[model samples]
Target: MGWLSMPLSSMHPHSTPKAYLDAQLTYERVIDEPAEAEGEGGPLPSRKGLRVIASSCLRNKVYYAAVAPTTDGVDGPVFAVVCLVRWNPRAKDGYVFAYKDMDETAGPNEAECPERILALLSPTENHSALQWRRRCIRNLARPTAKLEDGMRIRFASPIKFTDGYEGQEFFVRKRGRKTALAISEHGSARYRVTNMARMAFSVVPQTKVHRTVF
Candidate 1:
């Protein structure tokens, strides 16, 4: 079965919005607990083993994201909070997920939604822009179709992320004629019209190395 087939309960250990957002702090404390309690000196624990948390959209203007610490300290994972559109009474329970290339222009040919606006705002290197665009176009495009009203749209890539360790998910809802995007985290509560054009973009490169010993 595919990853999406897994139940949300299974995919997310921290189901609540607050717990999900606090995943990073939880791991940090786990790393510091022994030292703070015993005043003993030891090597720091590896963070690479941590599990990434998933965020959920709530009925209100709130969202949650979560992740556990990795076993190796080389990498850390984090999730973001967002407010997405409420579930539609008229359709199935799932939400809409959208994507587009940062370099791609929002032309008349594109879907008539916030995604087009986002495409215009997204920076050239938005990490998941291309992947998201592909997913949205693939899933949303049809010869005789329209994005149903109240359908939720999730971004293929998480938003507002700096390092791989921390990222955000966007939840969008169409209510009547207006579409809104909400940031579901604890701090700095705010919502805006789903605008892909204003988001930041960056790319990370992978490298390989060789070592020799005598």
Candidate 2:
């Protein structure tokens, strides 16, 4: 997590792959909403200055990385967007990536930025490299154990997410040789059970899952 000199404009829709723009926009809008008050710390601050520089969708969750200037409206060393309520806003389901350093920077004297997220802001790496890596891993992965309806699997672990899954274990609703569908009580999203590339996300009845994962 060193100096990332890439201009923020590089993340705009015209500059990013069309496949990613919509999800990034959605995440940006989600973070822009006023934070809900939960407890002692009260509500988190509004992030009007935070700019999402990269995003990728993996199964049911979408991950994003963002940056903000250290000082109010000026430039220089920046803070990374790491303290998000990691869940589907509409569903109110919670997924936790418990980082002790929720907000950190790359500059000296500041807490070190989380390297996994910081990689999304790397200048040497191609913008879409992480997305491509995830696609490849998802497509090639084979279940080491045969799956059956009602069997619970920690499938999210094999993908090597920077932050490991911190929610209920996924129970198989249905399974096939190549892909399967998982369900959690709090969230049920539309999914394409046959194909990974055509996965979709929409709030569905808790009993229905329209998408699948390999």
Candidate 3:
């Protein structure tokens, strides 16, 4: 009956409000430069055009923000923040309307959109984002017989890279019942990992698989 009471299918990418919150916390940035500052520079991760902070609420509230750099003026810094509320209790598709303006025809406050974008330029969030990225990179592989291309497989035991760096996972280039051709994340080398029948592969989260920005 309540937003939080919605079924799991309602939050497709997340299983619980905590999971959704983690996704938000793991995706936002707070920048040091003014909203007007040009040319981008920040940790590769957590860099986006929008910084989002979300809280669990009956309507599943989320705050989308853009921040401006501190200034010599009394205003200090500016924030262009927009709030969005989930209107549907059974779907993930309609949760995108800008808060109070849930009407499909009503757009967000155009005046503040630019200011909010400034906050997304920060890279401080990357420290935690990268950690989460690596952690989420893993998932239990299906049966070795079901291995597919692009799947990063991890061995039951750890393995070392040629340059002395150690890694336990490799991208599956070619799958086989007994063995598979795989490549490393570094892409500098190709090697064979045996005992496929006993191995598990890692998968990137669907939300991140196609991410081109922070």
Candidate 4:
């Protein structure tokens, strides 16, 4: 039920608390400038945003850390730092969504939503790539109500981007086959990955962040 309960220090020696990891994930401009990111030894991975420190709890009442996350931040050129603290899958029903607000018809938080960096690539220049890329991140942000067999991520509803791309809905449904990340885009093809404990995702782009002043 805690971090020290696992085996990371003996191996990585940089195991910190979840709050520390959360702070790293949300980089700051003044305090964190553009210096070289921390190596894997630190609570945060050498590749900051690109990797997510996730943990899963089993019926045995022990928590196992997920391998470094492999995501492109959904391949976005620009994105904001957000946090996802997944509850134990084995927890009682109605607790999955953190689901207290599961029944609430709340809209997606734009500030927390991942962004697409279209330096010069516009709809006319290239729309297909931008559309698909957005979907990847949107899916990553969305949450799955219930955990099912062979399932990894499930975006509750399709996210619509109206700021730039029209009719752009980032939607995705991935399945986990044992230890492999069996993610299929529609039915075109499936990308399988082994070793769920530790993974490196490169599909999404690196994570760059900005500070918001309230």
Candidate 5:
């Protein structure tokens, strides 16, 4: 963790990404219908703030993040779409990313943030430049582990995330060398994964998830 004073924008007046990044590490969540009482389905989720995961921005466009599709939303594998966006009368799925603006669709979040992380380094040290480069490399590299159907992996990081859960994992359904489709019985939405997010993951039996999820 380091202090980085990025160019001040009315968009992000703060000088460091750590404050926002750290806030995303954990979040309060609300899923499904906006009800105030328990019913036949289950307990109702609160209107409190949600834990933001990944984010990216396109000019003034902004976005929050989410993990899964709501019970009434569409289902399937997709890279992303505004229809999957959330946190308002707009996003019917769930409150994932909170977009500040729109480009005929949704806004962006941290996914597109530049790699120039302002780490704490001495301006006078030549080695500092090398160290920063190395850290960025490690942050951007894709996961090397192989993925196949039926395997489980944790959502470590995403190269391109349209939909995701911050503190959840998924079971692989379909996969490629650099990407895979994953499903979750818990709080996770069925989202795609890139090699970067596949790092340092854990495996769980499908049956175990089934028995425990309910």
Candidate 6:
């Protein structure tokens, strides 16, 4: 099968904070400096390192946009902009790791904060969450994956996170015995649901097996 058709098993998901940081390092280098000289007319101020423009969560991913300096001697203070993106649970907040914060001398795991931030934004691997997310996406695309109360539907792995005060999981569930859909989180013996889409769950029972598929 082509890359698009390849199963998720074939995809090597990033598992560690270091790996994620490494993936971003090269791009970070390009954008961590001022675009132009002080005498030149650059739109942005001459910052020593990267500047975060936006850091927020969208769908199930964290999106970040920032500005960096360019190596090439382009006229009018050229700069290299960078975007740091990662898939995360829908419930978590997005975070930006500023390059200006890194200091080797006054460091005692200084990168730990950013690493924790990334971990918070990382998607859960819990089977239930993944299955629910997929079902919602499928419903949006094909309009047939809807589930109702008493329906036996398979739940996939959920996305889990522990960077915050407590660990959390994100999954999908039928809304109050109705056809409406909902995204939910499980923490401290309580389940809180968030309305991800307006479509209600179908009253029809699911014919598929309820086993953990993914």
lDDT for model 4: 0.29
Q: Pick the candidate with the highest lDDT.
A: 3
User: Model 5 over residues 1-214: C-alpha lDDT tens digits?
Assistant: 1222222242153322333333433344455665556767566553434232333332222222222222323322211211112222222443323322221112222232233322221132335334434543564665456566667666443233343333445666643444444455433335543333324565655554345665
Higher-scoring candidate on TM-score, 1 or 2: 2
lDDT of 1 by residue, 1-214 (tens): 1111222343267543334334523453234334444556755643334443443333322333333344544434332222232222222333211112111222222222223323333233444444445544553453432333233335445443211122344334446755554444233323443333332322223253678778
C-alpha TM-score for every candidate: 0.20, 0.27, 0.23, 0.17, 0.32, 0.24
What lDDT score goes with residue 53 in model 3?
Answer: 36
Question: Which candidate leads the pack in TM-score?
Answer: 5
Error of 5 at 149 (Å): 0.7
The runs of at least 3 residues in candidate 5 whose Cα sits more than 4 Å from the true structure, single-residue gaps closed, are: 1-126, 138-143, 156-167, 175-178, 185-189, 205-214
Candidate 6's C-alpha runs over 4 A off are: 1-46, 57-156, 161-189, 192-214
Model 6 per-residue lDDT tens digits across residues 149-178:
333222232323222222222234445553
**Model 2: colliding residue pairs:** 191-210, 191-211, 192-211
Which candidate, 3 or 6, has the higher TM-score?
A: 6
- After best superposition, candidate 6 residue 167: deviation in angstroms? 12
Q: Which digits, one per residue and each the tens of the lDDT, describe model 3 over residues 1-214?
A: 1223344455568754435543543432444543454577533332333223322322133333433333232222233333444333334543322233221113332211222243333343334433422232231222344666666666544554323334566666654443344555445336554444434445543233665886
Clashes of each: 35, 3, 5, 11, 18, 18
Let me know the TM-score candidate 2 reaches against the reference structure: 0.27
RMSD of each: 22.0, 17.7, 20.9, 22.8, 22.2, 17.0
lDDT of 2 by residue, 1-214 (tens): 3222222244344332223333333322223445477767665544333445543333323333444332233333332433222222122233222111133221122212233545544332433444443443453453334445554444322322223434334555554444444545334432322233232222222354678878
The candidates, ranked best first by lDDT, are: 3, 5, 2, 1, 6, 4
Runs of candidate 3 with Cα error greater than 4 angstroms are: 1-145, 161-165, 175-189, 200-214
Which pairs clash in the backbone of model 3? 34-69, 66-116, 66-117, 67-119, 84-99
